[model samples]
Target: MTTNAELAARFEEFADLLEADDVEYKPRAYRRAAENILAHPVPIAEAVESGDEDAIDDIEGVGDAISSKIVEYVETGKIEELEELRAELPVDIADLTRVEGVGPKTVGVLYRELGIETLDDLEAAAEAGEIQEVKGFGAKTEQNILENIDFARTVGQRHLVGEARPLADDVLAYLEGIAGVERCEVAGSIRRWRETIGDVDVLAATDEPDAVVDDFLAWDSIDDEIESGPAKASVRVGEMRVDLRLVVPGEFGSALQYFTGSKGHNVRLRNYAIDRGMKLNEYGAFDVSELEADPDADPQHVGGGQRVGERVAGETEESMYDALGLPWIPPEIREDRGEIDAAEAGALPDLVTEADVRGDLHTHTEWSDGNNSIEEMVAAAENRGYEYYGVADHAQGPGVVGGMGLSEAEILDQVDEIRAIDDEYDVHVFAGIEANVDAEGAIGLSDEVVDALDLIVASPHSALDQDAETAGERLIRAIENPAIDVLGHPSGRLLNEREGLAIDAGALGEAAAANDTALEVNANPRRLDLWGSAVQAAIDEEAKIAIDTDAHRPATLEFVRWGVHTARRGWAEPNDVVNTWELPDLESFLH
Candidate 1:
């Protein structure tokens, strides 16, 4: 089956190839279509299998041309046009363009001038000092490629949480529906809500392991069954690898604990158990000191003795931790970074949750690159029962691609529209701009335009390659701008695609704290900037935090959950986030 993710990747590659070949307009069109398709509620394969071409075409950014191509790929498992373009370019555009400083145009230039078609070829050219010989590529450019190539290679393996999550949910639902399955839950990093995941791990409690395994193998979503046994099965679903383990009801809790681990956390728990004359393993937590030690016995046995000793705790995760004299720690904070001590001391924070957020402060509309209109976005926020909604469209400036940012005049016009819309609904609609902060730390909008707004979300959209000292200073300047309310997506990193700017978070947080500006946890899964550690540093400095979706469309507003959990991981409470306040209080804080 052609998953939406797979289809999106194809269209994105088509865009890159088109841009590389100097083709005009089509690249952006293809890229937009790709983005919409990925976000579409329905699966592309299901729509294609229904033979409903209009259903595919109805996707926000897709048109007849892209729709036809999608159908072709769905029916034949290939698109001839894309294949032709790949043959023509004959370059690994995706891999090469992933380097921080490289884009499709640079990839094309390197390919045309030096026949650099792959990372290996690019590396060899950079090493041999050949890339510098190319016309526009200088010695510095060559050196940067060599430095970033290694990072890019390692990034390609992980899938963004947003992309892998839907498939995981589907698999869980499918397994839960099967008879004889007693309990099921997702384990591993997904359970911990990591920003990115390598694969999905599911654990099920069932008396009939053989029946459960057979049911899993027969799942329609399975593209390939990699391995199968009475108790476990591994399958490939779209671009994700899913591993399922069926354990007896008795050991479900212990198995979950063992599987949902950050290796280091488990090691700490094991040592703690050993100190108490107990043994902890996947099967259960058992007291093993009374049993005689048998050095020659098979270590695979649960407790390394014929008598497994007194059973202490194993039926529930809470009990397992209770047996160890600690509170049940939230999975998000299970990074072994003082969480165990906090649990033991009964000082674990009451973490922020999805329900605690009052509204979204950073969102876009058709005035910028967003698919939905201002009215539509506000309605979506209202649907979520938010106390307030901020419409922060991109302000016209450098790095604002495809003329997606609003001009000074357009921004003023949007304010009127927002005000009129505000009167029509219960939700307070605050008109604002996601103004670009230049390298020198100046916002793009004029003082008058910025002052007239209810909120101002200043973000660094360009000069992302600056070093730590420079980036820190650049962000500090933006924070100091009196008109700025929130420093959006502070680092500008795009998950695996780009490393973005490097800065000292503690210093940046201090500057933000001093300036009375809030730093954003931009919850667009791919760009969960001010990631856990950075969020913690900001919190330590007493700087305010805002968890906004940076939503480009109505449906995207739900991404706030990702931001909320990320804040929780950083020990941020409801009081720490400005958006968690009521409308009047939030407005007062902004003022």
Candidate 2:
């Protein structure tokens, strides 16, 4: 089964190969095929296994030839055409093109001109002044390549939604508060609530574009300036690229709609407009060629590029949806996850709200891995006006191998301290333990210790090597334990770095619901496991969800916004999420 990400990459590689050969039309075909593959609702393998090429054709933008290739790959576990193309080029393509700004043409040129086949070889050529000798290659390009090569080497592939999300929020809040800015939003993949991000893109409608761009460039946290134009600016905030675009109010919504794209989604929406006798573009819908309402015309060309629908007001996102006769689509659902279908069907979920959240369930104190003391953690929750908080510290068995965990005795000893301090706070603070689940599918803490706590968060911290079936069963057994209140970070994955344990999320979700155990959407930014898709599966199973920061410090508690965003992306509604329950309901659920 090729994951959407993997399939997308393969298509991109094919497109790049075509570009290297200067092949026309084929690149667009492959790119379109890739888009459809990523947007597919079910596994491509399933559709192909049944010998149904219609499944491929059913996907928007996928044609017969591409579908045939997909079927070929599915039937034979190989793409002969792609393999042939790769063999022909055979120039360490993936590696050489990975250099930022170096595309397939540049790779072809470098290989032909300098015989540079690897990163080290490229570095050697650049150092020896060999690259500038090639046509269309200059000193600036070589320097840029060298400067970004280290970045390309050291930089992680993509940032998880958890990690990229916070920085975006901080930047948005700052920009939104600016005096002349009318509306600010995150666009691109982030707006679509993608699982990973290459860069953080922000779009804003401002009365003062110059001032806004100036202020953005002057952001105190900016580590380096990449480029600055009149309407847009790019900066390197730590390792991530942050791009800010300023536009006039009249063009805001259209730009938002244009930029907040999965590309496939945009193409679909554009076709929808074309079918309705309207032309959709970055500026707004416009009158194009009118088809009909014509009795004699083909239905496919009825509205053929005509701009019949009303223009969205204010050029902002909300108005853009209104122009399309739909409500505003949230960022997460913009991935084409039946969002357009829901829009056309008029049955989209209301989605969860931050205000619906009543308490912070999973937290930590200095007794274990966290930085804040029990009292301080409680005080912070109280300051947030939370009705309650759950203090869950790490249990000893995972060991101090990471210098971030506690001993089982120390965890037990902290209960008395938690109880003693509980009396001083206005809100309820439930004592809990974040116990480790060993490789053999068993939690480290004894039932005696687990039962002693008000809540037990069982999580896999080691031996994340089991196959999907085995790991799913392991987690299902843990969820069935009457003593365990929650399953923590079901997949131990770390963003952009590790894949973590493999498990069948649908099965785990069913077990969670059946056993009356909740699943923790660990919102650590690095480990937003039980991601939006998994959260949706849990929702389907009637399982409860807790969005916890797993915060190790007081400042980190603010990460709840990311968790909330992720939950909303999963199409969670207020009632569907357990954290939305008030204190009494929470206690009943936990018990």
Candidate 2 regions off by >4 Å? 1-155, 160-182, 206-230, 287-314, 399-411
In model 1, which range of ten residues has the least summed lDDT? 298-307
lDDT of 2 by residue, 336-411 (tens): 6678879878888998877877777788877765656788888888888888888888776542333556666676
Q: Pick the TM-score winner.
A: 1
Please give each candidate's TM-score.
Answer: 0.95, 0.67
Candidate 1, which segments miss by more than 4 Å at Cα?
52-54, 289-307
RMSD of each: 2.3, 19.2
True-structure lDDT of candidate 1 = 0.87
Put down candidate 1 lDDT per residue, 223-282, tens digits, no spaces. Answer: 898999989999998778999999999889888998999788888888777777777778
